[model samples]
Target: MKAAPPKATFAICGVTLLSFALLSATDRFADAAVLGGFIPARLSGLAVPYALPVWLTPLSATLLHGGLLHLGFNLLMLYFCGRDDEVALGRPGVVLLYVLGAYGAAAAHYAVGPHSTSPMVGASGAISALVGAYAILYGQRRPSKFSPEVARWLHIARLAAAWIAVQLMLGLVSRTQGLAIAWAAHVGGFLVGLIIARPLLRWRYRKA
Candidate 1:
């Protein structure tokens, strides 16, 4: 049988592309980032003219990107992981993961730097959730010396550590190059994915 189309993934990518194109064309990248991106300080009563509500910024931030390269990388990840996840989780499950991931990432960022004024933009945090789900859904399980429960938790712990290390390294590299990377958001989003993957899978096939 032919594979099902990943309509939700395509729709997300298309919207993100259009948003970046419009912002770039109008030279409104900064404007959009301020108005739409998640600003941790905003949660603490920082005021801006016509800015999106603090609660909504997390979702809106996913629609904005710093540059073509930023947008491209996120879209690529979304396409690969999102498509495969859609097959297992179905469209609603995938969408739930992405949305929750964005909020989870924002929460983590705020917890770490609540007073930060920097605007966090890009779908990477949200996509990190998808990447986490992909890793769990498709990762090979190794025979373990420990009991099943202990082994499962250990596997999760290992994956989480690896992801955190990678994000930390990326953060260091970006900092050296005078670019900001939301490594905390990535870790937070990935953890959310890992936590939800099994539940969502069971939910998807509950009747089966």
Candidate 2:
């Protein structure tokens, strides 16, 4: 039986939506994005005007989205995957996973696009981490005839492959439209989710 969705999941969604509404209402959407979004170049000391301080952008970026479509897709993913994760990992664990995932996303963007000034906005990276945690926890539900360790690794490999393929395809599509997709950040966040889910699950069980 499925557990009730955790309150933190809804609260995070509410915060994201409320912040988006307020930011959009108070300034040009582009202006807010520029001011709050993660721009790797800012950390690299580029001259991008209106960019937030380098230290602030990673967390701030999670609260900004390019459009309704962007926000909607992320919130949808976050609700479903995040609910499952929260059920398994608890509220504090989910929030920690999300914050670390955002940092992971920013690290990946810095590794790949250190000099690029494009502001990376949206909750997709953090949501991708939640999806990864969900994949690890729920994807290996049935006991396999193979060794449990082998089965778990195999499941993760399949999920990772599918995720990488989809992100690559999205990257191509974004490029065609003259936009950057930050596939690296997605991969980074997903990797963090996969890595931490098991430990977080154990910690939750221990606490119980």
Candidate 3:
């Protein structure tokens, strides 16, 4: 029998599509982002924005993207990694990992850029979590398609360093252009995924 589709993957994609459509179809993009995007100051009670509640922003913000490239990149990563996770870890487990990653990302962004007023939005942070999970799941082999096998930890470390360096460069460029990029959030999400992936995998598979 054809198995049922992965719920987490479909749900995430649906929400992202709906968000992009609604936000782009009207003039409410900025307003929606402001209302839904994570603002650490608001969440931490250091400041409050009247437009939206602080607690929900972290999750809501995951549904947002800065542009088509941003959305496409996140969706591609989510499709590849999220489906694999759902198959390996079960629907609930994958969803929980994603949510936890989002929260972790928010926490890190809050820590590093607490005073900034710009709202942080996008699924890269959560997607980075999936990348981390992927690393843990398949780290025994060489990560890059073009490379030979290496030590698992070394592969993960190299990938993490490269990810951080690229994100930092992009963040710097964006900031210089009056844009904000929550690259720190990406690091946090990746860490969360890396830390939890093995335990989650063992727990899920051991029972199956």
Candidate 4:
């Protein structure tokens, strides 16, 4: 059957296309690390004092994955989180949330990380934000009545909380080893989603 028109989001296909394009560029074009960002590239393009400077790298970096497993895992999560969200928020809202989350990730890195002119890259922050957005917006849902038949998978809050713990733990591990991990970014982005999710959902409801 032909798909019914998307209920909330606009240009849903476009967002998916762009995301795939980023994957191709980083995976195919540069042949660099795919899932994560690089120190050198993160530093280039756009600067402002004490602000989360938007850069082109975050755009592509969010799609690039480090390895097959890395990309695959994130893609699975994104499929669950992003597809629904894009459908809910439409293109503009999707873009806004993604950018905000990405920037939040970068800002956290800059704030806590020791002054290394390293380029930061990765979609974990943004994707994590998407994860966060899903958690917060879904906010304490019982499994739908059909849950036993189909949706009986997971609780939204539980998944989001678990993910947060994992990110924080990973960051601590990185810190202990003196390795460069942008754990702070994940925290920041996740928090951004948490803080604003209810409002966004309310707005969407009102808009509808």
Candidate 5:
């Protein structure tokens, strides 16, 4: 059977790419980041110069990227994991995951640094959710001496540990480079994905 096109993924990638290009070209990238990016201080009632509403910044932040490398990495992950996830969860499910992931990332970021003035940009946090869902939906199961349930949880624990380690390393690297990486947002987004993967799957195939 022929597979359905991943319209949701394509749309998201297209919009994100176009948004970055237009903002960069018009020299409004900085403005956009300040106005649209998720700022932890915004949640703490910090006023800004004509910025978007605090509640909407998380979704808006997904459309902004720091640089070509940042955008490329996110789009690539979205294309791969998103296409496959769309197949299992359908368009709505994928969109749901992405949107929820963005908010989840922002919330986590805020929790860690409520007074932070840095604006969190890029789609990585949202993409992390998709990656998390992908891990759950398609991750390989290995042979283990433990019972199936115990082994399953152990597998999740390992994945979580590995993810955190990688994020911490990335955070360290970014710190040295004078760039901030929201490792907390990534962790939060991934947790959201892991928590919702089964429910979304069941919702998709409810009639089956």
Candidate 6:
């Protein structure tokens, strides 16, 4: 008989890409917070195919980041928060979460800072959304940390929720004084990821 297909892991390529992105960001921003200097830039949503104009830094800045400290934490978060979604949603679902989460983040940042040069670059926006969806899916279940069942990871659910609420609230309140927090991106990405992940989760729970 043919073997069953392998299940997906949390974070998946998001973690890896984030890892390398952090490395690049670190190499470039070791001295100062050079936001969008590194990482992938989107040219024109559909024009660049997947990259942005370097001059349009702060616009899609979250796509970039700096330092292992930043990257490591983000990737780690993605791993934990991303698991349930990946396991339940499958690899393709994971990809959808990442992509949609990215769009959510980028959309928020772009809308907030259409004319700013702050440069929003990082995986937090996307990861936060994955965390959001994961939290919503399994927030009330699991052990709130480690679970013997791979399908019921709890620690991630808690952290993801906390992170999303904290970031969004902070960014919104702080933005009034010209202080940006990328909260919009977090909220937008998370909501999008959560919506996209819903059906995938349902599909995974079907009885044989």
Best-performing candidate as measured by TM-score: 5
Model 6 TM:
0.60
Model 6: per-residue lDDT, tens digit, 84-112?
56766767777667767777776776676
Give the higher-lDDT candidate: 3 or 5: 5
Error at 169, model 5, angstroms: 5.6
TM-scores of the models, in the order given = 0.86, 0.84, 0.85, 0.62, 0.88, 0.60
Superior candidate under lDDT, 2 versus 6 = 2
Give each model's whole-structure lDDT. Answer: 0.85, 0.82, 0.80, 0.58, 0.86, 0.58
Better of 2 and 5 by TM-score: 5
Please give the range of 10 consecutive residues that has the lowest summed lDDT in model 1. 170-179
Model 4 lDDT per residue over 161-194, tens place: 6876765555455455333456777787777776
Candidate 5 per-residue lDDT over residues 1-208, each given as its tens digit: 8779999999999999999989889988778889999999987788998999999999999998767767776798889989999998999999999999999999899999999999988787898899889888876578889887777777776766765666566555556534578888988898898889889999989999
**Number of the predicted model whose lDDT against the real structure is largest:** 5
Better of 3 and 4 by lDDT: 3
**Per-residue alpha-carbon lDDT of model 3 for 102-178, expressed as tens digits?**
98999899889888778898887887788788877777653454444457777788777876676566566556535
Which stretches of model 1 miss by more than 4 angstroms? 141-179
Error of 4 at 124 (Å): 0.7
Q: What clash pairs does model 1 have?
A: none
TM-score of 2: 0.84
Candidate 2 lDDT trough over 10 residues, lowest sum: 170-179
Candidate 2 lDDT, 12-79, residue by residue in tens: 99999998898778866677778888888787667667667778788898998756666676788889
